[model samples]
Target: MAGKKEDEQQKQLEFEQDEVLTVLARSGDASAFNELVRRHRLKAFTWASRISKDPHLSEDIVQEALIRAFLNLNSLAHNHRFLGWFKSIVRNQALMKMRRGGLYRRELPATALQTASMHQASVQVDDINSIMDYLIARSSQAENDGTSKDPQVLLERREWYGIIRAFLRVLTPREKSIFESFFFQECSPQEIAQLFQISVGNVYKIISRSRQKVQEERLSFLIRAQIRQRREDGLLKQNVLDPVSLKESGGSLLTGTEQLYRFVKARHPQLSLSYVDGMLLGAFLLNIEKSSVDMSSTNMIDRNYLITNGMLNLGMRVRYVEAFDFEPPDPNLTTEGIALAQGSVDLGMPAMVWELIHSEFGLIYGYDDMKQQFYGLDTQSDEMVPYEQLGRLQTRSLFVLGFVGDHPISPSDSLWRWCQMISRHARGQDQTFSGFVNGLAAYDTWMDVIRQRAIEPLGHAYTINVLRQSRKHAMICLAELVSEWGEVKSESEINQTIFNLLNKAEEQYAIVHDRYVELALLFPVPSGGEPNEPANAARAIELIKHIKYAEQLGIEWIEQIAERLEEHASRAHVPAIVENPPRAYIM
Candidate 1:
């Protein structure tokens, strides 16, 4: 009687303390709020358990409810009503959790708490109904006919037993023993709990967790078995890539090329996306054709040649296949190209595809031979293309590129090749499209189009966005070079000079990056802002001009770095050998 009286006194003190704490918590006292949680967390869990009836689910509900309450404390009407408001939140959370599980359609009955205690027992009782019915029917038939049991019937029984064994194998040894004793041997949970020397709740939890684990594994095992049987019967030929996600780009052919490059780069730890972009000249490329800023100008160069050259520079042996290259599609070429694409996907390498969906490059990462379909993703989204219509989707052209192997190349050789490519691309020395003005000339054309208000708003905006992102990467690449050079223990004065040049180059690109960013704001994508307006167009022109001058300065410093690399090569004079030379198949 005294203990009960002491409990009442303690409860009175707690309620008074909570009233003061709630007022402090409302005023943004974090420690006061923490004290309130400490006092009420156990009571919250109990309330949630009463409402949810599942202890595991109740735990989650309590946690989420507390977070919601904390986030919404300011909405409480009265400080002294904190407990009531928190209880309401906990109840709402429990209901939401039940609704998501599809278990709360109507109001729960008053006897739900009593019935929930028997739920585990009911499930265990239902497990034997199917097995017992099957056995009883088979025994009755055998006795009445006095004939040998059907072979198929025995096989079915064996299959059921095999499944049981498989499920047991998925459990730990202790779990297997406990589960067998409780379910197969018909031992009560209390007896098992005592035998295992564990609490009754622990026994229930272990059984629940083990059952869920077995059920999940059983489904996966059955699925794989079904697939295997279908394959053996020649009913299916399907291959789906797992755990693959495309590294999206700003909608350029380099998007597809970079995806392919990433797969090949997995074999070389020395390569990174920034490094690849630097080597591919993707970050530095600017091509404006016919004094117009159009869509095609972003990728007007020889795509196949550039991709092949870039991969080779990285020492990756590339396999290139195409059915149409500025020519009519041939059936023979399509067949060869499709076969190679499927083979590359089968080898777990994403194949770069041209016109896979729209009139642009994409990737074919998976296929289904029986369904005659290929799974790919493009700028639009993931798509399933019919196998026979591989090259006839849009442009009636097929182009695919993948890496077969790699050769050895020193970092110095790779850097030198990259610098040479950068210089060539910046100088427009390797421009394949005639009307297109590349490099510094391209920037002038961009400004001319803006000044005349002849810019294609969408294309201009896209160019601004892509180049802005690319130049940001260019800045990162230059900074990476500075760090790499700083790490070299060379005493050569040329090394320090080159490092200084790289820093200067990085600074120029940083300015160029900022200019592009300013332009992007003036002509935000899809909407293109108000670039068609004279004021915005004039501002865009000025930004482009600034970008051009800074880019030119960056290129000058890059050329100086290349000169220093040449000097270093001369000093070594080791007769730099190129073995196998990064082979490519252009067919």
Candidate 2:
């Protein structure tokens, strides 16, 4: 009788386990969902924790990942391979997060692990310790010897373990949240931003810069280690090289300094690549000081006055765009902003630098360089690098626009006119004029739209938002052109729409707030003139009614404008668009 009871108990336990797996395999089972999460929670947590180097974020990443997994379960048509599929999602999400943060680490492969064990015995004899030793020795020399074949290598990798672990103390809650999404939770930047209700660029900037901060800690560690070693070995006193002196005496590498053209072009060939030269010149021109800040007071009575009058010069475009509009803080032209944007170039900046060296290429490089100079000061020699010179040399190796896209152009009032003027010139020419301009235009648009769109930096945010919305519209329009099963025979309409949208995206905001903000900052008025809300909303309504108004206007409305004031009262309890004149007379 006792043996039979034991048998029944064993069967009952088996039944319960089977039920758990079955329910997990099926949808609609809340208990099973909870069980699945509970079971995999630690594994997910550990993965995110390792990546983010923050534990609270680890929890957040895991929690968010599980929620997303639950929401997106419908996409998982099969269950048998769920674990592998889910793991893939987690890995992708983590990588995406890291990509946004701009934190890159060399990918470690299983081969690295296998080799670690094979050389364990001999490696142990050599007294290998500290991850730095493993990383430094293996990192630069991974190709030839396959010296990674040692189990002890894993032990030595523990050095970075503490460094990552220490990241918990530094992050703010939001940053911690972002870090977890990147390092631990393994959700993509798009996933996380959508999860938290923010822009992808915002997500990218937060995550990328956060890792930079933590990596800075690692750099600090290296510096301190050097200092300590030097002290222990009887080097000079620390008193001679304090932090204040170090800062005052030297510029941060992260900051820019004028370098010899040969030094930059030769040693850091990747950076000095030809395409980078154009970008460098363009960036320098973009940041130069403007001649006149106040357009209201300045006489622009004629169209050609921009050129004929000192007010309407190409140099004016350079200074105006650089001063009030630039968000990257192109301080002294070669600011950190330029480096950050350029660092994003693919193939490489060297290649891009090479491309800018040409005249026939865009000649905008020559145009920009010749017109704008550092502080509007002229150089002793007009020492312009000719366009033809770039053709003979290998183009700088930047592959940014080659694969996914190209290097970004800084957009300001100048870029819009520049592209239009160039495009206009291309209208009836057999020359490669427009194509080159188009390429530059495309590059600049990418920079303005994609790069800045990510951060949606202060000055350009409104414009970026409008353009992004329009791009989304273009994408949706393209989707509409497709049938249920396939694509259109020709995507000409789609292409044209995208092209048109990009062109308009450049000027939409500048025109709307045209010469308004410029005046606001100029006179230091305690209370600014009437906001554009009443007038602009009225115009917006007119624009809407003139066409399929509601359908035409797609940008999300902001409540910050006080419900359009006078328009607010008119629409308060009613959704009607009745043209009430009293609403326009708010004063």
lDDT of each: 0.66, 0.33
Q: Tell me the spans in candidate 2 whose CA falls farther than 4 Å from its real position.
A: 1-105, 110-112, 117-217, 224-536, 539-587
Query: TM-score of model 1 relative to the true fold?
Result: 0.52
**lDDT, candidate 2, 82-198, per-residue tens:** 565566566546544543552333332222344445433212221112232234434435435664455554454453444455644567888878776655444788999898899
Which stretch of 10 consecutive residues in model 1 shows the poorest summed lDDT? Answer: 578-587
lDDT of 1 at 322: 58
In angstroms, give how far residue 73 of model 2 lies from its true place: 7.5
lDDT of 1 by residue, 359-434 (tens): 7677777777656577887766788876555566555566777656665666566666667677777887764555
lDDT (Cα) of model 2: 0.33
Q: Stretches of candidate 1 above 4 Å error?
A: 1-242, 245-254, 264-272, 325-328, 342-348, 357-360, 366-387, 489-495, 570-587
